[model samples]
Target: MNSWIKLSVCFGLCFSIAGCSSLSGMFGKDADYRKNEAELAKKLEMPPNFVLRRSGDPLVSMNVSTAQMLEEIDTIPSFRAEGIRIESNLVERWLVIEDLSVKDVWRGIEQFLASQGFKVEERRLDIGLLTTEYLARKEIAPVEQELTMISRLLNSWRDEMVDGIYDRYTVRVEEQASEVRVYFSHHMMTARATDTTTAWRLRPYQPMMESLALYRSMLYFGAQQDHALQQINTQRVYQEVKEADELVGLRLAATLNESWDYLLTMQYRANWQVERQQPEQHLLWVKIPQAATADQGFFSRLFGSIRTPGLVGIKLTPVSGSTAITELTLVVEEGNLNPKQRQQILTDLGLLTE
Candidate 1:
């Protein structure tokens, strides 16, 4: 048989469209699919609405400016923009799947989008780290040669048969890698339901019963939202960023971790870098915007995220050794970003250009 033909034949035997959407219906012995899912879920300690999976990490190196990317972005067609259609009135919004895993889906989406007149600017991946830990343990039963001893001893108090107990396995996938390196690690949590029910009376009894219960638990807890992720056709990507310039000020402000010293006395010499090579056009770049007013710790938005709370403006930062992929910043208005706000930014850059 041809190599590809042989591979296809093998998959034909193994893959089947079965109870993928129903957690409660997926249980049967030799049904290793649901069993594996149960074990994986339990091993991760994933709660209802939590998740466990793997994919690429964001590549962080540059601060993208909206003005520079906007002209190019305007050409990109909107996609999968929330398949919502109300009364034939085309909804005016982008369909988004805001998950970190969107990176894995964008590879083909960008192409599909280009075929439809859309522009996609792929962000470089920033390597990060992953960590793991163990959450539980169980006892092992030894086999016995004596028939009477084997049936009456350890098997007498067997929870699976009498109390309908199941040992669950959960797994957690986490990432902690830095900008240059990426790490993947997992932790597990396993335990049995404290109560029992009279269920599953059949040949494939113990394993099948436990499997169903575990699967049910996984669904009861594993739902997550990917709001910042965008998808088109079958491909997914980070939503186009509308602002990174205004982000610098927001970030710088967060670093202070406090309301800008409300009444503190501080001063900043204003410097606007203006450049207009063609005299016909004008370019005025202010490194900082006004301080962020919305409390983000309460909102939890990504840096440079357009889904970000709101934008007044933006700034740029070079990837220097001192530059962190993430920064907390606050840039006040000429005399308003809090008295101490301007001082902090100027001090950090050592740009006291009198």
Candidate 2:
């Protein structure tokens, strides 16, 4: 009876150890996950019409231009792919894009202005002019450096309101020889407060703001951020001859070719009609309307009997000694022009060279 009990106990112990081993094997550390992952991926089914996209070529030959590469890819050429630079002088600044069509530049400018939240008040496709409505906004608060607790508390208590300012921009696009130039002009209005009331008054022109706009436009047109910033910071100084109050001619630090282009651009900006161009003689015939009828619409001029327009002659002459300098003079041919009229015409043209 003792032997039978001992054997039975041994058998029970062996069975209990074997059962524990079986349980551990069933619920132990997981199997190789990498193999399981491969199996799962193989078993998974892709959705219908699914196509894997491949990467593009990582290397391009140095001889191939960006436009050529775009062509090879069957992609439309954009301003970003074209050569772009900023040209500025004391009085004006403009963006120059090479190998781009005027239509492309015009479309890009429109898109850029729209993206910047500017409402187009006027646009003339024939002359490539765009004017935006006044964009009103509160002035930005001045940054405070190393503020103290008391100062912070006082600032918090203050209303933190800022005066309102309005900004309007004018953009002109001109095609020069093989390049397209974009000009930006800015006007501003600010709120003035007095003891009795506050009113909006015309503010002085801000060239810095115009430069910033040009910088932003450069980025919009596909210029590299660093390159655009560098171009904006780089200043090009042109020698300007300040004429006496009596003189009517304007001196420009540009070649004859450049002056001709500038004159064309001025005509567009001033809404002057060019009767004819004498390139050989370096003369441009323009018709200037009187102030009374200057603001009249095309139909009004067409239907309404109007006074004869003043015929003005513009002469471009190269400076005596310098090949890069040109002198622009105005001569009234048919109608008499007062000093103010001649001055105004010169002033409008002077913007390009000023």
Candidate 3:
């Protein structure tokens, strides 16, 4: 009876120490410390026979089970991947929402734009393209009911009352392996004072305005919480590469049809305005704009100093792969692009992957 009591006390003490160590291991400052504690807990299964007064065979089995439970806790996702994340680069930004389908994002975008007072002028779900009608400057924001004379005068100087200023937004959606990439393009229009009618011409793109629009969209997506967002273990199967000759292209794990649809939808995004697409020849003639200037907060001119609208060809070819797996290669037509210019163009196209 005494021996049993001593064993009970020993096991009780062991459990108390193990529980505290396991809790501390979860939030220790150093990773090594947690690892060592886990190892020590596993070793506790076989408490010394001298200390236990008898062989601790039962205690050994219990320790193994406790060690496994602790290890399972470590497999949980990191805090960042647990929820939606708003990420951005120089040219574009995207949200990482786990387990969200392309269709879900498409619907969310339409609802978001409408909520922001943008009338959906056109929508094509089959191709996943959405364009908003030009929203006048006045309708873009709520009107201030009361304005002092000094404030009104300041508004005049701030171009707040400029006539015929309006903005248009376009959203592009592309499906990645497990997530979606959303791209937003902003177009502006100004009414010519000389015209008798209301005619609006395309205005230059503003980086700040574009970023603001995307940020708002991300907020809306997070608030909806319609789909479950969690971390997914995915591989980098889609990649873009540049050849020794300075030609740029993509090596995707998707088939020709999948790649075609993705590229076609992406044309509406950013400044890659599509002129024509020829699926037969697997070629597309696109009008890519020159880089923005210092006034726009980006470098000037992409391919050359003389910036003019011209057609650039994009072609896709099937590499080698099985029916279930497809390997497609993307390449530029390389019409008049010099070696240096080709390298620059490749770098710009690489941003498409992001």
Can you give the TM-score per candidate against the true fold? 0.14, 0.45, 0.36
Ranking of predictions according to lDDT = 2, 3, 1
lDDT of 3 at 224: 29
Stronger candidate by lDDT (2 vs 3) = 2
Candidate 3 segments whose C-alpha is farther than 4 A from its true place: 1-133, 136-165, 169-199, 202-215, 220-238, 243-247, 264-280, 286-300, 305-310, 322-354
**Residue pairs in candidate 2 whose N, alpha carbon or C atoms collide under 3 angstroms:** none
Report the Cα lDDT for candidate 1.
0.28
Candidate 3 TM-score over all chains jointly = 0.36
The lDDT values for all models are 0.28, 0.71, 0.58
lDDT of 1 by residue, 286-316 (tens): 3332222132121222232223222111232
lDDT digits (tens) for residues 247-328 of candidate 2: 4566777888887887777566556678899999789998754432443243244424533446779888999989988887
Number of clashes in every candidate structure?
50, 0, 1
* Per-residue accuracy of model 3 over 151-184 as CA lDDT, tens digit each: 7666664443444668888888877788777778
Candidate 3 residue pairs that clash: 45-60
Candidate 2 ranges with C-alpha deviation above 4 Å: 1-79, 143-161, 193-197, 238-354
**What residue runs in model 1 are displaced by over 4 Å at the alpha carbon?**
1-106, 119-226, 229-354
- Candidate with top TM-score is 2
